[model samples]
Target: MPESAHVTEEKTLSESNPFPDSIPERLRAQWNFLIEVDKLKTVLRQSPLAAVERRENDAEHSWHLALMVPVLAEYADEPIDIGRTIQLVVVHDLIEIYAGDTPLYDAEAGRDQEARERAAADRLFPLLPDDQATHFRELWDEFEQRRTPEARFAKAMDRLQPFLLNWMARGGTWQAPGVTADDVRRRKSVIGDASGALWEAASELIAEGERRGWMRPGQG
Candidate 1:
């Protein structure tokens, strides 16, 4: 082959395969972590899409929450760092890639959820470079603890998104056997700690769901 043609072929191969043998360990680790988290796309949740028949997955759920942070920032009970809040939203559910999703209403499945997710985090987060793995884990832990304003607001969006989905689907999960408005109210009441306005709106949606016979009537 001509030298020029050989050079052109090498260029094409190099362009197509971006990874080089000398790539730093940090870059390789970060790339692997990004690729591994793609499994979140397959981790399905209980909430249904408002416009379609299928359920949403964890990746979609996190993206929705990230979007909600900036759009609904004004409703947060206290001021929040929008970028940090979005980061918290994105990190919150990545562990489900390894742990799998636990439905909000599934008491049986939830019994061991924290243990499962903690184990999953131990395996998954270390895929990243050490600094990033620690930062992301801290964000995940913060979201779980809900101790900061950003974490609280992030949690509110987490709770509120599924609530909105159920309302839009005309009782998506609420129609499940043995679930009731009271159960939902108790579970989602954390929304109040972050955003009273959103929680009030959520309460209204729950009441409307009960009125429409979408929810099992809770005994007073």
Candidate 2:
């Protein structure tokens, strides 16, 4: 080829493949991934903060659940790897950054929720370097599947956190129309499977909410 044509081709290739080496490229990719996931702080869930000043964002919720893993692991029905459970909780809601938070009680909001969240996960997790991306995606998937001991305990914490927060807030979301004691029990059923102690504690809170007139009564 002519020198001018060869130069043009080289420039095109350089533009298309900016980071050729894996190490530095991986570092850059990881940094970009960190920055992108920080957007999780901006995606707020329906659950209010303990203080009830505002709804908790996805980042805060994940961090809280990760913290809970160590503190509450003793209550798990089966032995759990606390570190793995923390990892599961931390990445569990990263997909929410793209999909937004869906309220548990809103049947309409749940329509196609799995597809939306899976699409979000597909787009977001691959932003990291390949190895790290794959690992994080697996952690996220493990949490979602909820079959393993770590995942079950992690999911229990996920449910318990909001349950405690709402109870403390005098029925934060429970006061919303159409939310009843039966709905609360149904949503919280998994807690019993993970930790009977936690399940009993949550039951007490539900009972208190009922007695205090925070949760609707006589539905179930």
- Worst lDDT run of 10 residues, candidate 1, spans 1-10
As a TM-score, model 2 comes out at 0.88
lDDT of 1 by residue, 135-176 (tens): 999999999999999999999999999999998888999988
Residue pair clashes in candidate 1: none
RMSD of each: 10.0, 9.8
| C-alpha lDDT (0 to 100) for residue 171 of candidate 1 | 93
Error of 2 at 95 (Å): 0.6
Q: Clashing pairs in model 2?
A: none
Alpha-carbon runs more than 4 Å astray in model 1? 1-20
**Candidate number of the best lDDT:** 1
Tens digit per residue, CA lDDT, model 2, 117-153: 8987888788887888899999989988998999999
Candidate 2 regions with alpha-carbon error over 4 angstroms:
1-23
Error of 2 at 217 (Å): 1.1
- Residue 190 displacement (Å), model 2: 0.8
